[model samples]
Target chain A: MSNISLSAIFAETAEPCLATPEMNRATIFFLIVTVVGLSCGVLAFIFGHHTIYNNTREMPWGMLISTYAFWAITSTGLCMYAAMSHVFGGTRMGMISNRMVWMSIICIMGAFATIGVEIASPHRMLLYNIISPNPLSNIWWMGTLYGLAVGCMIIEFAGIVTGLGKLALVMGVFGALAEVLANSCLGGVFATLPARPYWYGAQLPIYFLTSAFLSGAAAAVLFNYLAYRIRNEKMSTTVHLAVKSAGKAMTLVLILYSVATFWRLVSFYVGGPELGRTAADALITGPLALNFWVLEVGIGLIIPIVLIILSRLENMSMLAFAGFLILVGQFVARYDLVVAGQNVPQNLGWDNLPTHFSYVPSFFEFGVIAGSIGVVAFGFLMGERVFGKTFTQKEHH
Target chain B: MNIEDLEKEKNEGIGSLPLQERREFLKMGLALTGVFLGGSILSMTSISHASNQKNADMDIPSEGQYPYPKHYGMIMRQNRCVGCELCVEACKQSNHVPNDHGAWRTAIQEKITRENSTEKREFRPVLCNQCNRPPCVRVCPTKATYKDPETGIVVMDYKKCIGCKTCMAACPYNARYFNEEKYAIDKCNFCIDTRLAEGKKETACAAACPARVRIFGDLKDKSTEIYRLLHTPDSKIWVLRPDTGALPNVFYMNA
Candidate 1:
């Protein structure tokens, strides 16, 4: 092992091909779904954002922003978790860090797809983010650092595919650092808003990073289980241990995130701005009550925490279900957060609204979200086909 | 789930204020409902009502405009404003703002109710507040919206605007609207490009107001009406959503 040549290692770690008709069909299906959903966003872009999107002067943001946050945060979580395990080189979770690296890339791509549709001038975004950078803006740092992270992750993944461990490890560490910072900035983008007092403060950045772990672990477990199921192969013992370790991690983060969420609400009632308090009220008892209670708290937090405990880290089906629930809850949690901040009237008492302002995503907005999900599914299945065996190539130091 | 388990999170109380122990209160599940029904709910009502009256009635500038050489702003005389909405129309024509999608450089919000046998309407015309510490300018990643150093107006460089709407979301006044025709954000810029550059003394809205609702001028000129209005004792000056701390150049008064 000590005398092994670089060429020999490159020869050992090889990409897998789709050998069955069913595998080909699945990949093609996801590709078609992604293409169709993405086409709707393109059409909306060709028209005007106001023409297709249900967004109004009152509620400017809607579901697309929430969904974008969901995917982007998930990507950061996966990248951070993998980078932590791999770069630090101690946690047993490093066994599956390679697969996580691949997913993080795909998830960020999903985020980019949604935001690309949301922005009216995406072409300008690419140019202006570099030349005319606003150093004071959180959005600027989030965009720039996320772009850097994506570049690093892609190169690192390519290095991994070609069995260049040294190059992959170096890029992986840099990519993870960029992801954490970008992710914090993404939180800051919301937190720094003086207008939306509900979202204002330092808590969101920390909360966002903490929630990333919960989502990252769930996604890793769910995708890895699905990848193996596609091949109809039995799980190797070491890989099983890796998934179990992720489940434990998810359980712990889920509890912590739950506590963080509770305190955020409590703090709002205690001393937050009036407008901020109403925004919290909207989530607590107003229009978004069902989503907040049933989905975010009940399903996203409680059920996942309880299910992970009951499964005892062994049952694959139990773990997968908990992951699905956590993902669903986290998705709605984002929707509630974004919506609640804007739900209160900007004019407040003078706007003549019977209650907090309202917004429902137009058909195009839903299409954009579906498109983002399709990107995730499409990438994951293809990764299974192209790098199936590569994921199983465990590195234990 | 037990009392002992609950007691373990003793170190989690982070805030130093003597407010109610919200952590324990939250466990009861009724705290949210109670808080909303309380007096603080009224604090969520209006841009005007939400601000502390003492804070809103802040004394006008005494420093005599040394900070900004050309502090361009408007003073809304709320008592003089009628619900005619002529200013809203004049602004559209002057700025070339299209009528659809509620796109206007300025708007009149009429809060009306029945007073005895007559209907009383209170009209407040809202435009860009043009903050001294403008959140819109600060949040624009591309530097699309910026404070014009020459005049202290929050001006838009439409060519650079990517239509991200972060400015729209960040604005406390909801002053900005996406201009479909231009494919960029459009808002009241004190007529910087349209009229002011054309040698007009005041904004189109201020110029067209029959009731003399809007008073636009340069605060840098202490002789200008804006400075005089602010410097006057018993001025009773106010600004919209002052709690946001944007420190708007636009001030409101009732005389």
Candidate 2:
């Protein structure tokens, strides 16, 4: 609480905070958006989640779950990359590693904000998740590890800002370890259910880990590009090189991710369980077909890969654009995965049950999704404003 | 069929049954409840084309293998179930399930098949399977839904339920529903709280069924009809979604 402690942590007084007009304007805009979007979640809490959310007995999860997955996975990606770069210091990637750490923290917070509201009794979750913990449950592990990762990331960011290199590196490594485990646990949440054959398998956990890298690298490139653009400044050589390295990582991941998707989709047609095949059909030719083919495959995978490869890390703007498309595509991909996996009715031939259950997210669900994005955007701008010097110093390690 | 031949006969699911035997069973089903009994399609390998592989571990526990002294279970005499849905009404009244929420503790699934221009209608009663290895219990992050050690019935501790609805998604039977009244997930607990706790021997649904469709009792009690019926040799006994490996206590039979 004392000014000395605050100064020691932040490495500066409050006067220099919010000094830049462009930074202030952008930060304020996202802050407002965050408040407005989160209010919808608040509305759901006030008037029961059952009243607001379109999730039914058949399809108990909807868009918010997928959004939470997207944000959490993206955070893991950022944390992993940041930790790796910090460990192998003096690389161009390390130049932007500090910012990546901050963004990772922001993205996880966004994930928490979305999931906190999505569950009806978050208070009970907090209480019993500790007192009556179910270690067998993947969700429990996911929650616990992500919570640990966030704490480590906050302390790590503080170390970075205060010029404590040793402290930062140690905490960064621990944070990344927690995040990677949490990411796998998140995948396990869906993958372990034998009842849902579409999600049941060993591949999803690895698939999700792969996605973390792709999204993380894309986020790094996009954020760095925007950082320069916001200040109306051209990228310095180190920063440019940092972004180019991220673009290269993105390119590599995109190819691996494409192969993973192909195998995952193709396996369903060849000797997979009928229920699983039907679920895959929802993505391939049924209700979710357009989302899978267009947004997830076309924009998220193929286009970004093509763009990144053609640019060859030379065109910064093109790389940034590819990153943006990848993020959009990743968002839709998460939604499609979650929805399509549960599309087929568990009781398929009973009482005229439809082959696929329809789940169109309600307006409040969209609001919650937007709010999570706002958290990321606002945090990104705020980090740039408050820790701009620390991020660009280039003297660490 | 002797016990040795039964063992040798591949577990070909419902498809292995002789046409004459299947017809006799359906005829008995129709005579008892005015409808033919249809097998469940919820299995991972659809019941019609169920694999010949035997999963002995996935089957209901045999005599002396029951885990609890009062291992409660249900037998849906599928042949005897009519689409009257008196069980659903009884459950609603006994459990206080909200009608508008589309939640049901127990319901009947109706299937109509045509052969030679003659339509044969069927009904299969369904409730919480209360699996020996319950998916809901495994996935519940807060131990909100758990198996009662003594009764072996999956019960809900509403106080701990966060209403995450993960249990709902994990359940193969589509049993659990978010009860807005309790602000938690709710499902059939075999009427453990409402009926069994009140010194009743059977569930409200079993008591209300005019056709004797649902038979509920302790699997540990060898004298009970449920125990004897399930242990009967050469009988067609099956559980819904066998491939889920949930080891459901709820069994369906033609007896």
True contacts kept of each: 0.69, 0.81
- DockQ score of candidate 1? 0.50
Most accurate candidate by DockQ: 2
Please report, as a residue range, the 10-residue window in candidate 2 chain A with the lowest summed lDDT: A9-18
Backbone clashes per model, in order? 1, 0
Q: Tell me the deviation in Å of residue A292 in model 1.
A: 1.0
Tens-digit lDDT track for model 1 on A162-267? Answer: 7667888889989999999999998998999889999998899999998788889999889888877887876788888888888888888898998999999999
Model 1 misplacement above 4 A: A1-18, B1-61, B64-66, B113-120
Clashing pairs in 2: none
In model 2, what is chain B's TM-score? 0.77
lDDT score at residue B142, model 1, on the 0-100 scale = 96
